[model samples]
Target: MPEVVFPLDSTRSFTDQSLVGHNRWHPDIPAQVHVRPGDSFRVHAREWFDGAIRNDDSADDIRDAPLNSVHVLSGPIAVEGARPGDLLIVDILDVGPIPQEDSGPLAGQGWGYTGIFATQNGGGFLTEQFPDAYKVVWDFSGQVATSRHVPHVSFPGLVHPGLMGTAPSADLLSRWNAREGALIATDPDRVPPLALPPQPDSAILGTLSGSEFDRVAAEAARTAPPRENGGNQDIKNLSKGTRVFYPVFVDGANLSLGDLHFSQGDGEITFCGAIEMGGFIDLHVDLIRGGMDTYGVAENAIFMPGTTDPRFEQWLAFSGTSVTLDGEQRYLDSHLSYQRACLHAIDYLTTFGWTPEQAYMILGAAPIEGRLSGVVDIPNSCATVYLPTSIFDVDIRPSAAGPVRIDPGQGVPRSSF
Candidate 1:
């Protein structure tokens, strides 16, 4: 039986016995599945709930939580004979949805990312009051689709084991043992269970951006504005057709993916429940050199069109907010807030003499659409910075106009034009 290496992460608490890196031989093994350049394969991933509950169908189920709620991704089928330099080519073939044939308790069959059934202020910014936190429930006897205000924005959870490396550097923080139900199957043999160590925190990451974006996220987290326009979901549009690229790391990327989403609102405010189940995924990996080529660097960066990027962004934006509430939201006017943010970001790079295409092309590759650090957290409606770490390869700085160090301590962040 040709095997796949489960992408192993060691950051938080994942358990070995948990379905972390195990693979279920679809219909056949690696050899039987013929892969061509354009050929696609539809792999039906198990739901995050793994079909544990019996006919559960209410948001309360998600709120109440189930036994295996921690999240466990499946896979690690070693390609028939994929090698180190070779890339994994995938195309999001199509979604083979698990119809309401056996509906989930918390997630309704008609549950889309937005609309009456959408998750509320999740981890996103909201002008709504905590006491008045609200979510409009939808009534659909079947599928989670709708023709309402939302565009047909579909995408894959495209999750991976997260830790696919050999300690790139000795000093690097090890994320192999992240506390969850996962195990690094070194030889296809069952690994022993291990206990978690005390004291910690965790999440996904991005390429090094010299901390500009990182600081921006931090500053936003610390700041808070009294009221804001809306709670933008800031979700990555992973509809049917989109190929995500990741620079090759460990052997075959030691990939693992869970947190699959049916639909996720932007800013991920409500979080990744729709993202909880697996999606039929297709991928094509390529080895691109010089990580980020032209996108300039900012401490905290986001590309134009907020809440949209391949790499996930996080922020302290949702403090004291009822992030725990589902279906809470409201939209507003100020369309330019997003436009201004994008324009400001592009202009920041253009100041370095790079054309918009240069900026766009470079940014298109390694963009790390960062989390929205809430200016609402602190005192100002401080705009969130769109920092893509890939900017480091471009060699520009916020203080490039002069040698200045910017941060929350620096009062306010200004573009050094």
Candidate 2:
């Protein structure tokens, strides 16, 4: 039988720091997730706002609500056989509704999932969209609630730890808190081979270029008012049924999480207007050993059918800079570099111990697609080039077994979109 985990067995106090008082914990699972059709697991979860507001709540509630202790996650359950260096594979068996007979919002059908970036409401892409956006504020006062404007989608915000293992301390808080910035692990098997960095004379910043990063930074600087947390770029992942990857910086992972969204559109342009709730969730975590791929990822936590509809897959490219066109501009200069990243993945996987065909098929099935989850917030730029599961030609199988579990619930973690 498959192992199952739950939230802190208490109604008010939980061992999970990320979800301690709110009853949410983020337990990261391995990326090499493998399971049969019958495999099942239960997760502990909490509302995005931690019982902040109620259905009858109004916009006024949002404006003055204390924007703290919102968006709770649950679980850090480790898989039985996972290790320190193997890939963790998550099999998304299925998703269903939690039967709640309470007087609050979830009258039978309620799960959370959103795209808004910023944690605090007030100003965001959702301003005009959600009438209550202006009043939105964080209120851990009572049962989790949000300002009255967001439409209830009733979808669980399936979150996964970005990186699984413990990360290196970011005492060096550069521009943003890299340490607390949801670290995810990757499989050496999935990463493309190490290629030369783009030449200064190479393509204009579109993806992975000095120019691109500059633009991104400039955008962050331009928008987002520097507050305690990393500005409006809220990207809450690591929720129920979500798998994330991270590098192993410490023997035990001291993971933190935040960026909880009640509901959001694809592009997190708006601050997820008043998206909060309260409840408990559960998860199963595993560790990866002897694997390190270079999608800039240390490990991968697989979430399936996928935590989201568009599940996670490794890709060589994510985003590119919006460089101006030259008089003699050519597609080769612009697209070639990205294409190479995709092609080179085959070699990268081989170095990690995969055969050419294995790597090729992996990429083939999971169309190395691009991601743009963080285009709206502080950065005016757009795009997150990535790989999708549809890229592969073969029916992929989980590679790891007997997962080693890693359940570390510490700190009030926050994420940037």
- Top-scoring candidate (TM-score): 2
Candidate 2, residue 257: the lDDT equals: 29
lDDT tens per residue, model 1, 1-417: 112122222222233322333211111111212233333343334444443322222334333333223233344323333333333333333333333323433322333222111122121122121111112222232333322211111122322211111111111112222322143233333211122221112211221123543432222110011001110112345434444332222333233344345444333322222333333344433332323233221111122222322453332111122122352332321222332343355456555554432222222212224333333432222234345332243334445365222121111111110
Whole-model alpha-carbon lDDT for candidate 1: 0.28
- 135: Cα error in model 2, Å: 7.2
Candidate 2 lDDT over 47-86, as tens digits, reads 4444443343243444444333333333233344434344
TM-score of each: 0.38, 0.40
What CA RMSD would candidate 2 show? 19.3
